[model samples]
Each structure stands twice: as structure tokens, then as C-alpha cells.
Target chain A: MDRKELEAKIIELVAISYGKDEGEVTLETSFKNDLQGASVQMVALVSEIENELDAMIALQDASVCETVKDLVDAVEAEM
Target chain B: MNILDELFAKAKEDPQKVAFPEATNEKMMQAAYETGRDGYIVPVLVGDGPALKALAEERGYDPAVFTIVDVADEQYRDEVIAKYVALPDTRLKEKALARRMQDPLYYAMVMQKVGEADVTFAGIDNTTGDVLLAGQMIIGLKPGISTISSIGLCDIPGWNGSEGTLLAVGDSAVCTNPNAEQLASIAISACDTVHELLGWEPRCAMVCYSTLGSGAGELIDKVTEALKIANELRPDLAIDGEFQLDAAIVPAVAAKKVKRESKVAGRANVVIWPDLNVGNVAVKLIQQFGHADAYGPMLQGFNSIVCDCSRGAPVSEIKGNVVISAVRAAGQKK
Candidate 1:
């Protein structure tokens, strides 16, 4: 719904996708560099985020958002 | 039983568990279902769960009949990532693991590497280069084997020879212009595969434009040197060459052209071409003009069982290749 909530949800999805603890995922944690998410995983992660937030997030736009905070910002902008 | 029948019988005895990373394709799904149903293999489909289930349902096949490994799920993702991290020479760490986990092929390879599955089959959705790269990077290479090659199992209608008359063309889909050493490795790998698949001791001929020293060129020299290297490396194998195609396969021609005695002369089942250009052209010519039944371009020399099928391969060919891969896996365990 909001920036904090979206960021938390994004972080949670990342953590779940990677099987990492929620505490390990941070705002600056990059999906590729930090989470080691491949292209398909990134798509899955973005899809999960969009479904949870019930918003239309462009895959192209989401793909460019490298970090969790960037994804949160993208979601907030769309909202 | 025929060669394929025997292979299927052997595979069905203890069907090797096979993982398909690109199981969403309709042909691939059909092949997987048929092979599993026929007891040739136990198919493990790796991909998104809902998508795979939906595809199976659309195809009138029950998804519950298949062992589906959903890489997107947390449990399967974590397990595959952990197995990958533990692999020898794995570059995938925590960050990279996330992305690699999303790849069905990578997950299938990890399953093979960890002994969860006996073999992995893909390349319908990916290229041969991609499948081989995943195999080499994840499943790793066989011990002391530096090169991974491909062998096209050719079955010519009227060409009669030993061991069901199956001929193998090497480096058909893998190496480009291998040096002498690499050529020797390809020859050896081809011999090993022919032996495993056809249950016959392979008489390998390193084919060239020249028969022995009759012709002169850098290519001929490479083939001759490859023969010498192969002999030194594997003295027990019946390998000889730098022979013309006729001298390699036709006994009458061998008797005329080959002045010296050789085991593989005129009776060779395994023919190693000088380069990919020749190998590719030769196999295709045989398949098209000669109306030969060509089975593979099967990937060889990997430690684990990984096979590549042609893009848009039919269901029957896919099932046959799976049996071939399973037979190889069974032989390797022995």
C-alpha cells in the first residue's frame, strides 16, 4: 500500500525466493548482486510482488529496479 | 531385440530417473509422458508448478502422474541452491544462487549432480551450446577427459557391418576444428559411447581425404597425428585411420587402397571426421541423400548423464534419446 509496506513485502518475497532469512534481505540488497537472482527468478519475484500489491508493474520497469528499495520506489510510483 | 529395443529393455529394468528442465513444450511433455509410461525412464519435470500443471492438463495428461520440481518454490530453490553451492568449482554463491535457482535446466543439472536424478535432458527450448555449457559448468566433465564431443548415431539401410551396422560420426554438433589432441579425445569419447549404446567394441577410423600417406595437407596431418595420439592414449581400443571414407567402410575398397594391415580398415563402425564442417555435412548427407536414420548428435564425455536433442525433435526421437542417455548412465554406474 505504502512505501514501507511495499519495501517490506518486496524484501519478504526476495527472502522467500532465495530461501534466505528475512533479516538478510535489506533495502540496498540487490536482487542480482546480493540475492543472486537470475533473469527468470527476477520475473517470478516481480510477479509475486505485483500480485501481492495488486498493481500493474511493468516487467521492463521492474527489471531495471536492481535493489529492493528500487522496487519499492517503482511500486510507489505506480501507486 | 533390435538395438533400440534392447536399450529400452535395459533402461526399463532399472529406469534411470531423468530430469527435463524444459518440460513445458508440448512435444517435450508428450515425450516425457510416453517414456515414463513405457517404463523407459522416470521423468522428473522441472519448472513452474502451476504453469506445468496447466500445460499438462491442456494436453489431457494428469500432472500428478509426473514428478514436478518447482524451482520457483522456496523449498526446491533452497535445496537446489545448496546442492549447487556444494558442487566442485561452483561459482554460484548466495546472490547468484537466486537467479540460477529460477532456471529449470540448472535445477535439473543440480538434481543429476546430487544423485536425485540419474540423467538430465534438455535443449528443445535451449541450444546445444547452452545445454552443453550447463552440463560442463554444473554436472562437470569426466575424469581425465578435457573435451566434450557429440556423436551422431547413423543407421544406414543397406550398409551392412558388425554390431547392427550402426555407425557413429563424431564432433558433428560440438567442436569446430579440433587440434590433434582434441580430435583424439573426440575419437575416444565416440568409441566409448558406441560401446555403451550398441554393446559392441568399436573399431574407430579417423577419416580424412587421404588414406594413410597418400594425400598431403594440414588436415591429413592432423588426422594422422590424432590416430597416433589416440593409439598411445588407449592402446586397448581398436582405432586406426587417416583413411578415405571408402577405405574406412567398404571392405573391397579397403583391400585395394589400404596397403598395410589394420583392424579398423574397411570395417569401422565409429568414424571421426576431421572437423565440424566435414562431420556435419557427412552426417546430413547420409541422412538426406542416403536416407539413413540418424539418432543423435548426443553429447558425450560429461561425468553425469546429459543429452541434447535437436530443436523441435519429435516425441519418438526424444524418447529414443532418453533411452540412449539412460543406457549410458547405466553403463557408467557399472
Candidate 2:
């Protein structure tokens, strides 16, 4: 998928991970600022992305990803 | 001194308040009562205060010595819940936190989180999942901990290894199938656990079927990666591996098989399994055939000490774990 499509899918997964609405998540949503960088949510988000999108995102790579766009970038690179 | 005696002495040196949420279970209540009576910890039993006291009296325990409280007690419940919610870094959101606080397990967890209690001990009547979930939501994870895992001790009957008949194994009862990062976290946590509980400078070896790149597979790859990550994350720690069990602990095997200047190859006191499958089986083998006494499967990587006793465990075993956890809590206190 392209960048826009990948980002949209990641937003949905992030929303589910943080227990928020789909519209509430955005590309600029910072993990540290907004989500407190919870490792549990990061795990849920990565596993969901891998299962639903067939993209294997290593936690080490995703761990440094500060924003929704950063995570999307990591996933897309793997794809 | 033996490990148990040492732990008991250390625990009594500075007893922490351990909250038992399963107060209604006779085994749990009796164990808590006896533990408190012996002064290894200050026991806080959570449930209906009157019913807990009555049950303790019926069971021939001194109810006055134990502090019993109820999550449904509006004044105390509101106090702990409000304190926990006001903490700087809470894991759960507001609505979910409120809903979970209704359970005694979560309430006790919040008690520990807010510093009202030192350790939260349960899981006699609750599932391990329930206990872990409550811990994650209330107590939160230690900084840099990717996931919650467990560590245990095996006191083998008639043998002496580098650590003198005792070996620490981890993640046997939790984290079913861990990725490389999760595996590394388990090793790091186990290192900290053995250090705190047994006061040993941990020589943690990540044990798998492969010995220093001798084998190749996804499983072996995971262990090798975990070793690298663990070393990277905590370079000060003695974490090494991609060794077979024999190579990890046995000097002779390690000398022949491992061809590197590895710190944790032969004289390793702690062994971290790749996943729960290997960990669970390894513990059973040690217990049944090796005739070793297993001390834990004690949960680690949380901000505070947490444990989930086997539902089938007898009161004696539970009391031992309580002492063990209390000692760890005491040592881990910063």
C-alpha cells in the first residue's frame, strides 16, 4: 500500500490500542506526549499491524518511533 | 545460611506491608495470618473486614494482628482509588481504571501503587491473567520493561553448581510466546530478580538449544538476538548466551562448546528460557527428576513486587512465596 493508505490503517490500529475513536488518532499524534509511550499499547499496536496488514514491525524499530507517522514509516519499510 | 533462612532474616529486617486480596480463601487468609504472626511482613488483608476477621478467628488465627479492609468500603476505597488516579503515570484510562478498582485485586494493586502497601500478593482464587492484568493496569511496568515475566529458583537436591545447588529460571508461568525483545526483557528482569531475592550478582545466560552459533533456526535466532539486545540495554549486567543449558551452566561443556570470552557461559547462576513452553517443562523436570524445590514463577518487571500463586498450591507453599516476595520487595525498595 501507499503512504496514505498505510497511515490510515495504522491510525485505526492505534485507535484500537489506545481505546480511542478512529478519528481521534492522527499522523502527528505523539506516542510520548499523547499515549505516555506505554509499552503495552505499543505491543498491541505492532501485533495488530502485523496480523492485519502482514507487516512485521520490530519493537526496537517501533520503540523509537515517536509519532503515528513514525510507526507507519517503520511498518511500510518492512513491507 | 540457606536461601530460605537468609530471605526470612532479610524480610524481618525491614518488613513491608503485603496486601492479600483473596482474603476469603482459607488458604490465603491462613497463610497471610501466619506470615504476619511470624513477622516476615505486615499483612494487609483486603475484603469485607468483618467477614475476614470472622474467618480468621474460625481458622484459629489471631484476627487482631492482621489489617483487614474492603474495596467496597467507600471511604478507604475512594481514598486509594483517588490517590492512584492522581499519580503522575497511571497505565489505565479513567473509565477503565474506575471499573477495575471495583475488584479487590485491582484495589490492592492500587494500594501498592499509591504507596499505601509495599507488595500486592494474590492469585490463589484468581487466574494468573487476572493478577497480571490488574498489575499492569495499576502498578504499571518498570521503566524499560517491555512486558511482565516470572522468575523462579530451583534448589536441586544433591548437587552443587556454580551457585551452589540453586539455579534461577524465568518466564515459566507468564509470557507464553515472547518475541526477541520480550525475551531480552525477561532476562534483564530475571537478573534483577536474582540479585534482589538471593543477593547474587547475576550471571544471566540466555539458554536455548544453540551453543554460540553452533545451530541455526528461528528459535536459536531469537535467543541470539535476545542476548544482543539484553547486553545492549544493560551493558553493566553479565548477560550473554545462545548457549545450550549444559553450556550455559556447566563449565566443562561451556569450555568445549562455547568458543568466546563469554561472561555468563559456564558460571551462570540465572537461566532465561526462550518461551513458556521450554520454561514450564524445564521446571517440571527439575522438580520431579532432579528432586529440586521450585521457589517461584514470581512475576517481575513491574514497578512494584507482584506474585500469582498456583491455585492448587498448599498454604505452606504460599507462605514461603510470601516470604520470598517480601524479601525481594525489601531489597528492591529504592
Candidate 3:
């Protein structure tokens, strides 16, 4: 999946992932600080990313990640 | 011909160390009395000694052929309950108080708990709730187990059309709305149980509407979580899910639909259902409507003792439950 498509899919998962109202999450929105996504949600996101794009990003590496852009970059590198 | 015969054979080869519950009913009595050729002669724990003697006499059960423990006397009752509550593994007072509110089934569980018997089978006339309550109150679930269930061995006649396969379906009678994590735990536990009962290292499938993430919903989410956790728990276990039945069991369909290269797909011998309601209905339909013979939905994850039985089950079925429980106890000890 391309970056734009990938970003959109990530948002969809994030909204459900955080149980937030759709369209509320933005690219710069901090997953932990602003969205309240738990550790389980991050793991789930990593799995979803792997399945969707057939790539793996170290969940440990992702744990230190703070923004949606960080995830996109991780996905890009893994892709 | 079945694993049951093999297990009974094993039990007979070691009869004194062989501790099996006494046949409380005529059918079980007949099975136990007539159960020869299998190595072990099991000990029977009957509620009423005189009643059992009367029935044995009526049924022509050689009073010499079996050893029976009459648990009806008050002293015996207190002794049994005290022993059950005293076990390092059992929480005695809580269980005693809980079971004191009930009758015979609770008493029966205490007998098993105190090592008066190796495996205890009750509930021929009792409800699932009754059997389970006795187990939970007296025997309690194994240390980490948060729930209980029934996993039946269903042999669908014929293979490729004539030699049918045997499958294990679980939580058919227990665990409602199991979360993603619980579902994963159930799958792993069921796989172990399948190995113990059927003598096969089972391929597990977490059944869902979706095939390879094609279907989406809360149910899919649960199955997906189970898949991830199963990988983590038993990395070597062959398991997969979030698939339709066709893809889960049929090789051709699975090859076309399921994306993961999983050993479990199209070859799974164990099926984990989403909820007890669905599982109970599915297994029942397969047994009653499809003419498949089922043997459990046995309790798992309990501590030292196990208590389980069918609702108004025949004697043969109850005997099988005992054998399975004994085998499980033996398996856990290892």
C-alpha cells in the first residue's frame, strides 16, 4: 500500500484501536499522550501493519515511536 | 478400537494403584462388572452401601468382584469434606460452605477431592450447573483457569466420504463472551486436551466468519488476537483462524482462500468456538442431528481434582468421562 493509502488505513485502525470518534485522530496526534492507545493497541497495530503490508516492525522499536508519522516511516522502512 | 479401550487397558494393567469411581447406577455397574480384558479393576464409591449391595445382588454383580466405598454415613461425610478442604491445593472452608448448600453432588466431589477416588463422575441426573458448582466449590478450577467448558470427541462417519474424522469442539457448555485473550488461552488448552484424549498432536482452528481477514468484526478481532497469542504461547503449535469452516477444514478451499501458510488450516482436528451458546448448539446439532457420538465438554484448568458428567448421560458415557478425567489427571501429573 502507498503512503497515503497506508496513512488512511492506519487512522481507521487507530480510531477503533483507541475507541475514539472517527475523524478525530490526525497525523501529528500523539498515540499515547493525545489518543490514549494502550500497549495492546500498539501491538495490534503492529500486527495489522504486518498483515496488510507483509512486513514486520519491531514492536520494541515501535514502542518508542510517538507519532503517526513515526509509524508511517517505520512502515516505509519495513516495506 | 478407540482410545477409550486403550486407556481402560492401561488402567487395568495397574488396578491397585488403579483408583476409579464406583458405578452408582445399573448401567455403569454393568460396564464396570463386565469390564474385563482391560487390565485394571476400578474401585467404586457408591453413596449408599446397602442400596449398592441390593442393586449388585439384583444385577448379579459379584459382591466379591468389586470394592465399594459407602459415603453416606455422617462420619464418612465429614471426613471426606475435611480431607477435600485440607488439601494444599483446595480452599476447604469456602468450598465446604458453598457445597453445604447443595446435596449429593457436593458430597461426591469431596470424595474425589480427598483422594478416596482418582476420578469422580456425577451428573447423570444433575444439571451442568449442578456438576460444575460442585467442582468449583469443592475441587475448584485449576490455578490459572478462569472458566470451564465441554469439549466433545465427535467422530463423523466416513473418510473422504467413508472414513470420517474425529474433531474436538469446545466451551460448548461454558464460558460466555470470552475475550480475545481468553479465546487464545482456550485454543492452546484445548490443543493439549486433544492430545491427551485422542492421542494426536492436534491442529487447532479458531473458527470465525472471515477467511484470512476477509471478514471483519468484533469476532474477527477476537480470533486475530488468539492467533497472535497462540503463536507466542506455543510457537510450535499448528494453529490459525479468522476463517470460515470451509477454509478451515477443506484443503482446496483453504488453499484458495487462506493466505497464511499454516499447518492447522484444512487439517485442524480441534475447533474453538466464539462463545458457549454457539459451541453448545453446534456440538449438539452435530451429535443429535448429524448422528455423531460425543463424549465431553469436560472441565479443564482445575486444580488437583476434576468433576464432570453429561446431563442424564448413559452409563457408558459416564464411564468414558471418568476415564478421560483420570487420563487428564495422570497427564497433568507428568
For TM-score, the strongest prediction is: 2
Ranking by TM-score: 2, 1, 3
Highest lDDT: give the candidate number.
Answer: 2
Which stretches of candidate 3 lie above 4 Å from their native place? A1-79, B2-24, B36-41, B72-83, B94-104, B160-164, B228-237, B284-291, B304-307
* TM-score of each prediction: 0.76, 0.82, 0.67
Best by DockQ: 2
lDDT of 3 by residue, A1-79 (tens): 7789888877776676567765787789787789755344564565456545566566677778798778777778877
Local error of candidate 1 at residue B15 (angstroms)? 0.8
Question: For candidate 3, what is the recovered fraction of reference interface contacts?
Answer: 0.00
Say which prediction, candidate 1 or candidate 2, comes out ahead on TM-score.
Answer: 2
TM-score of 3: 0.67
For B1-334, candidate 3 gives per-residue lDDT tens digits of 7646766665554442223233555666665565422434454645566777788888876777666666557666666666655677443353333334235455556666666665556555556555655566566654434455556677665423111457777877667767776677677778777665545777888887888778788878888987787778778777788778777777888889877677877777788888777787888788777677776767764554354565566666656666666666565555
The per-model DockQ list reads 0.03, 0.09, 0.01
For residue B20, give model 1's deviation from the true position in Å: 0.9
User: What is the docking quality class of candidate 3?
Assistant: incorrect
Better of 2 and 3 by DockQ: 2
Candidate 2 achieves a global lDDT of 0.85
Every candidate's chain B TM-score: 0.91, 0.95, 0.80
Residue range B1-334, candidate 1, lDDT tens digits = 5567878888888788889989999889999988888778888999998899888888998665689888878876677667766777543454544655578887788778878998999989988766866676567666656577889888777779654556888888888878787888898888888777766788999998999789998989999898888899889999998899999989999999999989999898888999999988998899898788887878888886799998977888888998899888877786
**Model 2 agreement with the true structure over B97-187: per-residue lDDT tens digits:** 5556677898788888889888999998888867876777678788888899998898998867888989999988888899888999999
Candidate 2 has which clashing residue pairs, if any?
none
